[model samples]
Target: MLRTAARRMQVRGYADAPKGDEMALTFAAGNKVFYDKKVVKQIDVPSFSGSFGILPKHVPTLAVLRPGVVTVVENDGKQTKIFVSSGTITVNDDSSVQVLAEEAHPLESLDRSAAQEALSKAQSELNSAANEKAKAEALIAVEVAEEVVKAATA
Candidate 1:
């Protein structure tokens, strides 16, 4: 009976083990594909609900991304940060993550001075907007610029 119990415990442990050590990540911006089926260790996303970290075997989730940075951690522990203007992140049950972004750029490529100037211009446009639609557009621009500035500084 003790041997049988030990065998059952070993089988359960094997069954409970994670399927894989890494998750597949696909990051796309409009017509451009940044990472296609790339294996990753983790991903940190800025969502409208809040920032969350995704790892292998994460529960299925769909999140609307805010204008902020998305950090992708590769299997080798190297991290890549990309600033996304807006996006939707989908985590599948099969250990895959897909990010569809409206606009995205590497954080290292951002210029702090240029981002600051854009933020100032967006703020000025928001102040001078004549209609509700224009104001809304300017507000979005301001938010994106602000996030860009933050990413550049970081």
Candidate 2:
């Protein structure tokens, strides 16, 4: 079994690391890397079609993200949650997941009050939008701010 193999590797001094089907997750904003190649068990993404999970050896896919939370689960059962304004997720054949977000922040680091204030402001702007384009932009801002609040509160 896996435990026996691990024990043998340890006894042989062959680098006793937990072995599993791990995928590297990279979260980025434009050219800036928010999270480097961190090996994870799975990633929960909020795609336009709904929420989906990506695991190692998953079929290669590209998905448009909505304003919501992206959860990265490590092999040890620890979960990292991030709020993404909007983005695209690319699952490559090599079991690497790349996320390109318009804006993203760790849920644990966000101030709920600030997110609430931004949501209120965006809502007010949306109500007073002068044109269709302006209204669309304001709507997007409202959506992003709402997502931040939801993630922060969760």
Instruction: Estimate the TM-score of every prediction.
Output: 0.86, 0.82
In angstroms, how far off is 30's CA in candidate 2?
A: 4.7
Prediction 1 TM-score vs. true: 0.86
lDDT, each prediction: 0.92, 0.87
Each candidate: RMSD to true structure? 7.4, 11.5
Top-TM-score candidate index: 1
Instruction: Please write out the lDDT profile of model 1 over residues 110-138, one tens digit for every residue.
Output: 99999999999999999999999999999
Candidate 1, lDDT over the whole model: 0.92
Count of residue pairs whose backbone atoms collide, per candidate: 0, 0
Q: Which stretches of candidate 1 lie over 4 Å from their true place?
A: 1-18
